[model samples]
Target: MTRRAKRTRPATPQDEHAIPLQQQVNVPVLNLEWIKSRLNPATLERLMQVWGLVGRLTFPPSSSGKAREGSRRIPTADAHLLRKAGIIEEASSTITGGWIIPFSVVEEKTNGLRRRWIAWPRDKNRDDPYKANAPLLHISHYLPPAMAEAASCLDLKASFFRVSLPRETRHLFRCRVEDGTLVELTRHPVGYKAGPEILQIIITSAIAGVTTVVHRLWAAPPSVRIDVWIGNIRIAGSKSDATLWEAQVLRNADSCHATIGRTANRAPRSTPSWGCSLVTHTGRYP
Candidate 1:
């Protein structure tokens, strides 16, 4: 009598780059309240200004590059996140954006793919002598002496995390998915040439805003300076008995997470959260 052979499941390959069937370890299961709150119109307009969205700005022009047609291939996992977040949507004939530049979806590897957006390159309008300036911005790489104490550096994901954009600029961001469908971007993109410069300005301004708030709330210790260096915001300061600035900074950052984006302040915080509070929410979000 022949014994029945045991059946085993097929093994799945571990190729991270494989587009199909790849899974993300962390998908932010759509917090409706959070999403709705962030999408408020008043918040969107202010966020645009804080993000340096103004009269004239475009992706860097490619000196050695030519404009590619359609969208580049996107990893399945990364594309899913975009759709879920409402970042990318199908274009309609009435979509009144100015241009339809193609974009690439980027990836963030973990237990699986995270996210990145395809970007970088150029364009020109009539009569404007195009200047192909180098895509370089000053990055402040600062860290206090550490004081050998309990100083912490919060890695804020300020760059390319999605924010509001003018509807007219819709012509500037477009993507063609694998199924031959054209898509449009509803939010600001990551991996663009201007990301670092814009973020540096915003985060630095956030630091200043926090500074002003902290100063007003408390009296002594005028040295309560917190710096968000490295083009990303960080809660920089000392925790010695001489001051409680670190604690105050963290508290203020968490508080500012929402109100900052809504207030009329020139340094409008795009997202309700920034700096340390965002670090704490890493597990809660993606």
Candidate 2:
């Protein structure tokens, strides 16, 4: 049973500090709802007795990015986790003139076998308003430990389409698939302006959940972190810890078909950050 009152004193010598996270707690995917249920001020006051990082963990529920700029400095990892519960800005343009964006499915013939060639609609929304934005880690978020060696990549296949769309917005994503027939999207469309931000919400939740388990695992202290991008996630750490992190991610979400492959640990050759401003040119696929 959970205690209601806060613990006023420190853990006595008899307390088992060595107890592992797996043995202590199991947290599911964390979002605003999940955090509100237990991590609010009232509950956190009581939990401070248990976890004891209440001050660092506290953040404004609906605080915007601008609001956070003036607040006390929060550790990078914890700040990223707390952001999952904060209000996010929507980058999707307001629909006007009721016309669906035009699309075509012409896959290019280059690199036929190696790259994924899903039938993604070529969207013409470049001229349309797109405001998708998020707080992202620059490629050099931190320096790697010298002992930390290789890196690996995990691709969340067709990430945008995997997210289910609400009934009301489905019509806004209607597309023509080469044939004369029109199809309404039941899931988030790949080329849509709001798609990346929507996917970021869920991925952030998953990261918060997975990181809790990873940090408590025996292998965690010299931590091995798995960083995420729009669809591609990279797990970089010491060579020995790769399997440990991979296994935990798969266990966290069995349905996600995460493909593992060798990857360069260095930053991207193009501007060294994940936030890209260049609009995607029309391209063909399946």
Candidate 3:
């Protein structure tokens, strides 16, 4: 059999975190009728508790029957397993949103029935123009020939909930619970403007250091780079260095009380030592 030469490809899209302007048109603004219709009591209560540990929920005085505009609830499923896992509870009224901003519920492929909160740019009375920042670590920048031989990727669990919101901005995210009780988010919510940026800063600062790899001993720590885009972090270095960095990340997560999902191990066993040579300007990767 004859073999054909590999085909070329186009540049990879880097805007995984971006939301185009046109897509913002349909996010339903929150109202009493819509929330009551779609809000799952169990899910809301659970989110409250989960966020509470990270100082995301706070009980303030009642709204005095005042109405909060541009707030809404997204669809969610109440699962017994979630409750059993101690991540969800049966009761508690909690609401969150901001001034006149259009809020939408985003369904993620990996999120199951849980809805993500998103503040739309097209909403009226907007104070800040939303901009999506590029991911700090570009594949080409972080994974040079030497480092690409081994790498580790770590995903933080409920990373957004782990970030506490500034006290001054908490009021902007206020909403009313079932009994008309007013509460505000003390921690960063997924949809707000600065959430992703804030998270990147926190994670980067926590794991910023170079350490010697166990497999190779050197007089000094080898060159290691860390690039964090949102909650996902990639650490590339010598094999031993990657292992050491992974341990450091776990420790940092513990200190911050952040739960980390074990999706990728220290490094996949079958990862090729091809040094990303197969990658081209078209952004194809081996």
- Summarize candidate 2's per-residue lDDT along 29-64 as a digit string, tens digits: 223233223232443343223222111112222333
- lDDT for each residue of candidate 3 in 179-228, tens digit (9 for 90 to 100): 43344544455554444544444343233332211112211244555655
Highest lDDT: which candidate?
1
Superposed on all Cα atoms, the candidates' RMSDs to the truth, in angstroms, are: 13.2, 22.5, 15.1
Candidate 1 or 3, higher TM-score?
1
How much lDDT does candidate 1 score? 0.39
Clashing pairs in 3: 30-71, 56-186, 56-187, 213-241, 214-240
- Residues 84-174 of candidate 1 have per-residue lDDT tens digits of 6666676666432233343333243323332234333233232224332223434344543333223334444333443454566555566
What's the CA error at residue 42 for candidate 2, in Å?
16
Q: For each candidate, what is the lDDT?
A: 0.39, 0.33, 0.37
Q: What is the TM-score of candidate 3?
A: 0.47
Candidates' TM-scores?
A: 0.52, 0.42, 0.47
Q: Candidate 2, which ten residues in sequence have the lowest lDDT sum?
A: 19-28
Candidate 2 collision pairs: 91-131, 91-132, 106-284, 106-285, 107-284, 107-285
